[model samples]
Target chain A: MLTVEKVSKEIDGKKIVNHVSFQIKQGECVGIIGPNGAGKSTIVSLISGLEKPTGGEISLSNRPISSWGVKKLAQQMAVLTQDGLNPYPISVFDAVLMGRYPHLSFFQREGKKDYDKVEEVLETVGLTDLKDQMLDTLSGGERQRVAIAKAMVQEPSLLILDEPTTFLDIGYQLNILSIVKDWQRKDDLTILMVLHDLNLAAQFCDRLILMDEGEIVKIGSSEEILQEDLLSKVYHTKPEIVRHPKWDIPQILLHYE
Target chain B: MSKKLFQRDRMLWLWIPIFLIILLIVMSVSVSLGAASVDWKTVWKIVFSKIPYVGDWVTADWSDSAETIIWDIRFPRVVLGAIVGAALALAGAIYQGVLRNPLADPYILGVSSGASFGAALVIVFGWQLFGVGRFTLPAVAFIFGFTTLMIVYLLARVQNKVRLETIILAGVVVQAFIGACLSLILALSNEQLQTIIFWMMGSLSLTDWSYTAVVFPIVIVGAILSLFFIKDINMLGLGEEVAHHSGVSVQRTRFLLLILASVITGAAVSVSGAIGFVGLVVPHIIRLLFGSNYRMILPLSIIGGAIFLVGADAVARTILAPRELPLGIITAFLGAPFFGYLLRRAKREYF
Candidate 1:
């Protein structure tokens, strides 16, 4: 559904993303896994149109990303950035309703349809009770939930989530991923998310893209990408790979080396 | 969200009319309390007589001076006060949204300092725009006010991109430099020192229809133009990447909003001589009463600020009777304590 060809980004003579390329089919949830400074987030940003790649092209379906208008691109894709939203006095419901922004015209107010979608998403994200509360008053976990609810309400064809589980607890991390995975299954949605926890990525993603030093080192299923030698080579540490006892999914284990 | 009358549609219905009514009441009571001591009856008749479909329904026992006070002196002062207040408050709200900083105000940039410098030049050297007229000081002040913002914007831009921190840094630098220049000018020049000093402190005294004529179009048109950018402004409050992902041309929107809002603030300061807390406090108060949505906050701040400043200017005119205070003093005295009260009541750290 999405193709990123030989994309490259440079900042002040430093290569942030260098000639990276990947493609994900429809109904796929792909995880970008890497250590710090691997350009995983930068690649996702390039795909999301938040930043333009200095070299190479990205396309959705068949058209170049540059040809797509912002509102059109927004309608097709939703992004959950790692940065915290500003601490304004916007309420939870209002914050979630901002997802409808790209859909509505400049002067058009959010209607019953928009509100209904927001309500449904709020329920899905388990934030219905706190919809009226001020956003700044929310705990970090609650704020992450709100951000996820916002992305869900956009109802986009593709979702790009950067560090979605950063502020979440283990329970909510599992819960949010399950909810997202279920939504992807139901809608045939394409997801490209950045995750630090390789175990969660192995469990949730259909395929993994491993990055190192602004380059793609490997891209395959968990069985192919989670090898101990490959992981150690990329992570610069020794690691062990084991399967989930019940799910037959490969998970990472750190070594003392 | 929660079932409250304060959200979306109900907010438009509930608070706007209430503020409009309060604005009317305050304006009515305000014009009557000036040094001339016009009664409420005279004030009411003079105000109502000007409205359509009610021109001749009243007794005609009022004198010419009373009419002059209502029409020539007090009416213009009141309207000009509203314009300046609305401009400042809307500018404040816009700056806060664009910069995504709750503590920002119209004067947070260099508008006030630039205006003071221009007015100081006219005061210190005794020169006027085109060698003398009622509009000389304000005209020079307006030009200087606008030019300073341009310089600040230019200084803040790097690689044709403007960062929020750069803008704030540039604003602080320009403000300090201009403020120092103003102080030096004040110290060096002896004649007309009181005039320069009082203008520096800020006031609404000596305003007339001429001042109103200059400000009316700029403020009204600027505010209406701001409405079209409401979506962009709202998106901007989210982080830049979020706004970009949402399809906002973040840089273009930021630049347009900054220019429009600064223009509004410059116009207000040129005429009113830097009324301090109206811009800062009105938007804050509106966010507290309503929400932070600029669609509501902008309009409400317009009226809310109009009411606050009219009443404050009235108090400035009458609080000490024969000895009137500057409008800035009244606002700070009243706004500071009220802001403190709001802070004590607020459960969040909005600032």
Candidate 2:
């Protein structure tokens, strides 16, 4: 459903994302995993159309991403960055309802259907009770959930989460990832996420695109990519690979000394 | 849809009519007040007598002097105060939303200093347009205000990208430079100093129907235009990236909003010299009472500002009797403390 053909981005004479190419089939959950400064977030930014690639083209549905109107692209894709939304003095319901902005005309007010969709998304994110509360009053986890609810209400076919669980606690991290996983399963949604936690990336993502130093090192399933030698070389850390106790997935365990 | 989603509509019903009624009462009482002190009954009768077809129905029971005072002088001055107040408040709200900063006011983009510099220059030279003597000052001030905004816009842009912080800094730099020039002029021109200084302090006393005529339509049209962008303003408050992610054209919306706000501000400042605090504080008062949704804040600000300024101008006119206080003094004196109290008592973040 999405294609990135040798996309590269440069900033101030530095190649931030150097000729990275990848594609995700429809209904696929792809995670871009890397250590710090791996250009993972840069790749997400390019694909979400937040930033333009200097060298190559990125397209969605066979059309160049630049050719799509901002609103039309938004109707098809939603992007959520880490702590992107601020604590404005707006209610959760009102904040989520803003997601329907692209669907409406300039003078049109949010109608009954738009309001209903916001309400439904709020329920899905388990924020129905906190709908009336102001965003500043909510905790970080709650606010992040509200952001996801907002994205869900946009009704986008492709959702981009850039370190969505970066600021959450362990329980909240699982809570957020599970919500996205359930959403992907139910809606046949295509997800492109940048994940910092390797174990969670292995658990949630169907395919991992391992990036190192502005280049894609490998792209394969967790069993193929999450090997001790490959990760040690790319991350510059001693690592051990093991299987999850509950689920039969490749997991990483770091070794000190 | 949940009943909570309809709360904004219901609150609009409750608050708009209430504020409109308050505005009418303020307008009537302000018209009846001042040195001559016509009664409210005479004020209405004179007002009715001035209306075209309605004038024939009403008998002229009041004296010609009362009619002139009520219709010609006090009525237009009060209306002008309302227009200037609404314009400043609406512009202030727009600036705050666009910049995503609660402290932003209408004059944040050097519009006030630019217009003031233009006014001071005119006062110093005693320059007048040949056919339209009175229009020259306002026209020059309005043009200067718009030009200053353009300069600020251009200075803020770096390689075609305009940052919000850069825009504010640019505005301050321009204002400071122009302010130095103003002080130099004030220091040198002895006789015109008082006129320039008083104009800076702001007053509604010099305005007539003609001044009101020029400002009223611009402010009204600007306020109506502003409504179309309220949703975009709300989205922008979240942050530029979030706004872009939600399909708002961030740069274009900000540019249009800033221009719309500055235009209204220029028109108001041309008529009434930079009246302070009404623009800076009225939106906060509305947000304090109501929520931060621009849909409610924008409309409420237009009326709320009108009420606050008309009431303040009335006080400025009457408090010290024949010797009137500057309207800016009253707005600042009253608005600052009230805003401080609201800020301290606010349970949530106002911004």
Chain B, per-candidate TM-score: 0.95, 0.96
Best by the lDDT measure: 2
How far residue B5's Cα lies from its native spot in candidate 1, in Å, is 8.6
Each candidate structure's TM-score, on Cα atoms with residue i matched to residue i, is: 0.94, 0.97
Across A1-257, the per-residue lDDT of candidate 2 in tens digits comes to 99999999999999999989999999999999988999998898888777889999999999999999888999999998999588887888889999999998888888999999998888888999998887877899999999999999999999999999999999999999999989999999999999999999999999999999899999999998899889988989978888899999999887788
* Model 2, residue pairs in steric clash: none
TM-score of the second chain of model 1 compared to its true counterpart: 0.95
lDDT of 1 by residue, B214-244 (tens): 8999999998988878777877876788888
Regions of candidate 2 where Cα sits further than 4 Å from its true position = B1-9, B130-132
lDDT of 1 at A157: 92
- Residue pairs with colliding backbones in model 1 are none
Provide DockQ values for all models, in the order shown: 0.57, 0.69
Give candidate 1's TM-score.
0.94
